[model samples]
Target: MRRVERALLSVSDKTGLIDFARGLSELGVELISTGGTAKALADAGLPVKNVSDVTGFPEMLEGRVKTLHPMIHGGLLADRSKPEHMSKIAEHGILPIDIVVVNLYPFAATVAKPGVTWEEAIENIDIGGPSMVRSAAKNHAAVAVVVSPSSYDGVLNELLRNDGKLEAETLKRLAGEAFAHTAAYDATIAAYFAKKLGEETESILPAKLTLSFEKAQDLRYGENPHQKAAFYREAQGGQGVASARKLHGKELSFNNIYDLNAAYNLVQEFAGEKDPTAAIIKHTNPCGIAVSTTLADAFTKARAGDPISAFGGILATSRPIDAATAELITGKNTFFEAIIAPGYDEDAFKILTEKKQWGANLILLEAEFGAEAAGENIDIKRVSGGILVQTEDKHAVGRADLTTVTRRGPSDAEIADLLFAWKVVKHVKSNAIVIAKDRQIVGVGAGQMNRVQSVRLAVEQAGDKAKGAALASDAFFPFADGPEAAGIAGVTSIIQPGGSKKDGETTEMADNYNIAMVFTGHRHFRH
Candidate 1:
């Protein structure tokens, strides 16, 4: 037999409560509510029977003991189709509830405030709310559970179409969401307690840490066509391009993700600075990065890094996109996948969107991510299940750390460029080599099998531009062969973290070639 329509309404958030109650009333569904909900329904000019009226007990202990009674649970939990459960409910004069609309107290919000006391936080934890939700979810075969305000409209539509009845499949899906909601709540509570009182700062036991992240979006594909991938975002705040607001464009691709991350990390160094800069990224590395008085000039120098790679790359700037810079970018036939900045000029948008094929490929985002200090630890990875985690390589080649091993000293301009190259090399995969001229990348050799080969490859890519350029290595030169390769290719100055046993040999080789060299006393081996 079909059960009579009834609903149990208990909610702390009163958003759309009156309208929801009124809709249920229009369907001739009896509303049984506890405490505040009953008062709210009564104020809305709708009839509501108090929970105490059905349970036959008055609310005690300042409303804490309102809905934790046997009569309410028995009616909500009884199987309506079973004759024995129905007979018992009839004998006890209990009215079955076909729907439950509930939302928990604001425990997370209460504790989020500054200087909140433990007593206040404990008081906000609702016991009866979660219990009622669980009972309704467990017996969803005969009841509809509505926990989210977002689901209120859908539930109302279902009732409007079916005359206050819901399909079995819809009920089951709502129940699943209810369980997930409670599980996440309990996990947050457990993590908070362990962080505040139960756990020590440094314990080296084999601890299992489960991080829960929700899906941000589904990507077009993974790094390769055969692989599958999706993007997940942290629930808490700290993020970069992962949390950026996409003002325009289609879904981001795998290559777009790689380049955008690199560009985003680089531009953060200059975020909000009066001196503007531009960074162009390709294949998870910086092909062009430069700072200038104007963003257009910076982009010009940055694009000179590797024009071939920049053809289909991603661009990020520290300032707003101006008309001149936008014209410079849009005038080219180069196929850029994405562009991000603090904002865009109206004329700039006009030029980009007016193009024939611009709408399909171009993506623009608004983000202002500033450079923050790195964490104490860093993590690196390798193929075949190899992992490395340690303190970050924060050592930079300061002027005091340099030891002039060569007879010829570097010019002041050469020294400045050498420092710039050194900074760029650290972020590249090892064994890394970088060539710089006038504070911009000329050629970068990264992820090579050997140090000498990486140096040779960087110089080869630099070609005729290797003359008068400064070079930086991720680690110390193991032998003089690396310097020899650079010397033959016309590199003038070099910087490296020198702890090598063959340091004297390399110094002699640099002196023989009349090239200036400095030992930075630090290494930045990424892998």
Candidate 2:
């Protein structure tokens, strides 16, 4: 244990400062502070010595050069066990500082505000605070560093119990926390600068990538029941599953959250439309999706697309939930793991909670939609040894992006269904196939190892409904087998990226079957 005789305190967040300082003063420890902290302590009737008196140098550069002197750093960094270090401090008349408490300026909060100038942000960057923290943390055996107000009560209890001394283990833990605090602070500043530079140069990738996340929840288990799991939200706040508000139902499981994310993202694709859109997700893949003039119709068509897979699935909509939709969702032979929408009417909420017994187990979430949704987010996937980061796949195939390659061109109605199927296929897993008619997905095959198998699965699921429906592939067909399978299933049109070496063969097969094919020149492969 190391006894704390003298301590330095400088903080931007002065929470619990008075009580903590008073406790330290009662223990006969000398308190030294700078600037506003010193003034605040003195006004509270506590014995406080100004840092200017200890260093014998007045603060200059508008209080920027207050604590950078040798007297301050040497006092904190000197090794008490070393005879040479003690002799140098004694020869220089430097008093040893046993504890250092500091929290840096609010650089993260300052830059987050709108219309913040570079001059203002640069001024908020702390230098002296981080220096003292690192110095004390580096000499953890002889010094105790405190960086958060949350640790104040714990430290005070320990100090009181140990007669104003801190244990070496406690000091080591505090030092580790101090380093993490500085690391996160520096990462935020670096990200801000990188964004500014990228905007000016029109560059997408930064020279170095820095990310920070805060723990959101600890789940009961991971994908499997035996694995550990936790949820983390990005330090930079945005709208999505992470920002959703739980309105009803039991706690969300790990698999439920995963499927919720996939379902919500798929529904957001129709945010700009006035029509109601519904998407059903199973195991992070879209089982059914539809858009209609009414929410009830949307739910009916979406659920009809694949009733077997839609059972116990996650349901998401681009509009509010009303009475008619609530009744359809909670009716007999209909069940869902979760329901997500922008809002829920009073009658609808009551019916969902009181009318159906199974509703108690359904997770209900209210999320932001349309213009309020998050903008231009990054997608991250963890591989075996590292992570792969890329910009989100937000590319939508417009009329201009579609190139007619078949002898027969697509009709207006077929073109609309092609666009709708294209959007749904983008969210499906790699080697995906989607068949849709009138903006409603009739069948979807996802995560297959081969493209032809995926197409066959989708066509088989569609059955008689495959007639006159458009087909969408996440990527180009490697051979003519995929298009031939779709043609045999009675598919009227197909849309895919046209970058494969056998694109000519695929086009010839489409022409032979009198099917319309459009090339998007872009592929979406979600692994």
- Residues 300-401 of candidate 1 have per-residue lDDT tens digits of 888888888888889999888888888888766666789988788998877665656675558988776674422222333445765443444556456777
As a whole number from 0 to 100, the lDDT of residue 105 in candidate 1 is 82
Model 2 lDDT at residue 7:
92
- Please identify model 1 stretches exceeding 4 Å from their true place: 1-4, 9-21, 32-97, 102-135, 186-206, 224-229, 272-274, 371-415, 492-527
> Which stretch of 10 consecutive residues in model 1 shows the poorest summed lDDT?
203-212
Query: Which one is best on TM-score?
Result: 2
lDDT of 2 at 487: 96
Quick one: best lDDT, which candidate?
Answer: 2
Candidate 2 deviant stretches above 4 angstroms: 14-29, 36-48, 247-249, 346-361, 372-376
Q: For residues 1-527, write the lDDT of model 2, one tens digit per residue.
A: 46889999999999999899999999888999999999989999999999999999999999889999999999999999999998999899999999898999998778767678989999999999999999999999999999999899899889999999998899999999999888888887887787677778776458788877767889999999999999987666567898899999888889999999999989989888789999899999999899999999999999999999999899999999999999999998888989889999999998887755787787889999776422356688999998887878888879878999999999999999999999899999999999999989998989999999999999999998999999999999999999999999999999999899999999999998999999999999999
Model 2 Cα RMSD, 1 decimal: 2.8
Query: Weakest 10 consecutive residues, lDDT, candidate 2?
Result: 369-378
Provide the lDDT at 41 for model 1: 97
Clashing pairs in 2: none
Candidate 1, TM-score vs. the true structure?
0.79
